[model samples]
Target: MKVRVFVTPKKGVLDPQGVVIETGLRQLGFAGADQVRVGKVIDLVVHTDDRDDASARVHAMCKTFLTNPVIEDYTFTLDEAP
Candidate 1:
């Protein structure tokens, strides 16, 4: 199975990196871009044929190591390997 995870800072949390990127964009003549927030997308393959089991495992992974539950939020999707 394939799993895709998206991790991002929680709302109201100060994102210094995001701020820098936003500032850089405006300086480079990107006027329409605003409130740019940076996040991460992780893609990996898990050896499982059952969707439920794969989802459960991925959820566990997220809670245990993938996300910093206090200041970050995460979401994941599971699919059959292509």
Candidate 2:
């Protein structure tokens, strides 16, 4: 299976990186941009039956280490391997 994880700053958190990118975009004449938020994505391939066990393990890893809950929130999507 392929796992895709997205991690982004919380709504109330300050996003300096996003702000910088947005500024650069404006300077480049991209007026269509209003807001930009920087985030992280992780893609991984794992073999399993897609059972609760495998999903639980992945979630645990994400919670305990893969992300920091203090300023970042995360979500994931799973799909069959290609």
Candidate 3:
């Protein structure tokens, strides 16, 4: 199975990178861009066919090391490997 994880800043947390991006966008004439939040995407392959197992493993990974529980949130998706 393939897993894709998205890690993002939690609401009410200050995101310096996101603010920089938003400011740059606005300066570049993207006036409609607002509330931009930056995040990371991690793509990996887990050798399994069971959706439940894959989900559990990925969830553990996220809780342990893939995300900062105090300030960040995470979500993941699973699919068959190409």
Candidate 4:
């Protein structure tokens, strides 16, 4: 199975990278670009036939290593591999 993970900073947490990007956007004439947050997209291949099991394993992976639960939140989607 192919799994996609989206990790992002929690609300109210300070995002220095986001702040810098937003400031740069304003300086470059992108006034409408607001609340810019930089995050990561992780793509993984899990060897599994069961969607539920794959999701469970991916969740565990996120909780154990892929994310910082205190300051970052994550969500994932699963798709069958070709």
Candidate 5:
């Protein structure tokens, strides 16, 4: 099975990295660039017979170990192997 995870800051969380990038863009004459948000994506592949269980495991991994739910949010999608 293949899993794709997307992690991002919550709506109210402040993203300093994004703010720095936005400021840099503005300083570089990209005045139209405003309110930048940064995110991360991770892909995992595993051999599995039960896709449902694999999906649950990946979701748990994100919620428990990969992301901090207070400031970060994550969602994952699972794909069956070919």
Candidate 6:
């Protein structure tokens, strides 16, 4: 199985990188952009065919090492490996 994880700052959390990007966009005349948030995507393969097992393992991975539980939120999807 293949997994893709998305990590994002929780709402109300300060995102300095996102702020910088928003400011830069405004300076470049992209005034319509607002409430900008930045995040990351992680792609990896887990050798499993059972969806339930894969989900549990990935959830644990996210909680233990993939995200900062205090200020970050994560979501993941599983797909058949190509």
What are the lDDT figures for the candidates, one per model? Answer: 0.91, 0.86, 0.94, 0.94, 0.87, 0.95
**Model 4 pairs in collision:** none
TM-score of each: 0.94, 0.90, 0.95, 0.94, 0.83, 0.94
TM-score of 1: 0.94
Instruction: Per model, state how many residue pairs clash.
Output: 0, 0, 0, 0, 0, 0
Can you list the residue pairs that collide in candidate 6?
none
Error of 5 at 10 (Å): 0.6
TM-score of 6: 0.94
- Candidate 2: residue 56 Cα off by (Å): 1.1
> Candidate 4 local accuracy as lDDT?
0.94
Question: Tens digits of per-residue lDDT for model 1 on 1-82?
Answer: 8899999999999999999999999999989998888889999998989998889898999999989999999998887857
Candidate 2 vs candidate 3, TM-score winner: 3
Error of 1 at 38 (Å): 0.7
Candidates 2 and 5 compared by lDDT, better number: 5
Pick the winner on lDDT between candidates 1 and 3. Answer: 3
Q: 1 or 5, which is superior by TM-score? A: 1
Best by TM-score: 3
Name the regions of candidate 2 deviating beyond 4 angstroms.
none
By summed lDDT, which 10 consecutive residues of candidate 5 come out lowest?
A: 46-55
Residues 1-82 of candidate 6 have per-residue lDDT tens digits of: 9999999999999999999999999999988989999999999999999999999999999999999999999999999857
Top-scoring candidate (lDDT): 6
Residue range 1-82, candidate 3, lDDT tens digits: 9899999999999999999999999999989889999999999999989999999999999999989999999999898857
Candidate 4 TM-score versus the reference? 0.94
Error of 2 at 38 (Å): 0.6
